[model samples]
Target: MKPATAAKKLGIYLPAAPQDFQDSEVTRAEFNQLQQNPPEWLAELRRNGPHPRPVVAQKLGISISGLARGGVTEPLTTADITTLLAEPPKWLVAERSTHAAVRKQDLIAKKLHSESPKN
Candidate 1:
């Protein structure tokens, strides 16, 4: 797989990865190995992340759009994420509630749709 594909699957920011990982193609076996038992570099990246947008959103408990609304446009390191978690700003609180409400609504919609008669 291409580096971008591998990075996406790993939930990492591609540009933040090491040059070798960025330069190489990852075979299926290698991809699996990386997933199952990441090397130190990979582990470090995940552990002290300049995480990808989706990852940042998940850690912040906000939707992607909510991130934009909160001016969190850039990727954040694990420390930065932790700080946000520890002392959530008003926007963060609001966004979390909004995210939870949206998820609840989505679940209800899916349940209702699943229970409806098929055409």
Candidate 2:
């Protein structure tokens, strides 16, 4: 797989990865190995991340749009994310509620769909 694909799967920002990792393709076996037992660099990146937008959004329990609305245009480290979670701003609080409501609606829709007759 491409380095970007590998990085996306690993959930780290691609540019933050080492040059070698950015330069090379990752074999399926290597990808699996990395997931099962990450090297120190990968582990450190994951643990103390300048994480990608998707990761930041997931960590914050909000959508990418919510992040944009909150004016978070850049990647954020774990400490940054921790701070946001600990002392959520008004925007973050509002976004979380919106996210929860969307999730609830999604669950209800799925339940209704499942209970309906299938073609």
Candidate that scores best on lDDT: 2
lDDT of 2 by residue, 69-109 (tens): 99999999999999999999999999999999999999999
Clashing pairs in 1: none
Evaluated at residue 99, the lDDT of candidate 1 is: 97
Look at candidate 1 and tell me the lDDT of residue 94: 97
Worst ten in a row by lDDT for model 2: 41-50
Error in Å for residue 72 of model 1:
1.1
Clashing pairs in 2: none
State the C-alpha lDDT per candidate.
0.95, 0.98
Please identify model 1 stretches exceeding 4 Å from their true place: none
lDDT of predicted model 1? 0.95
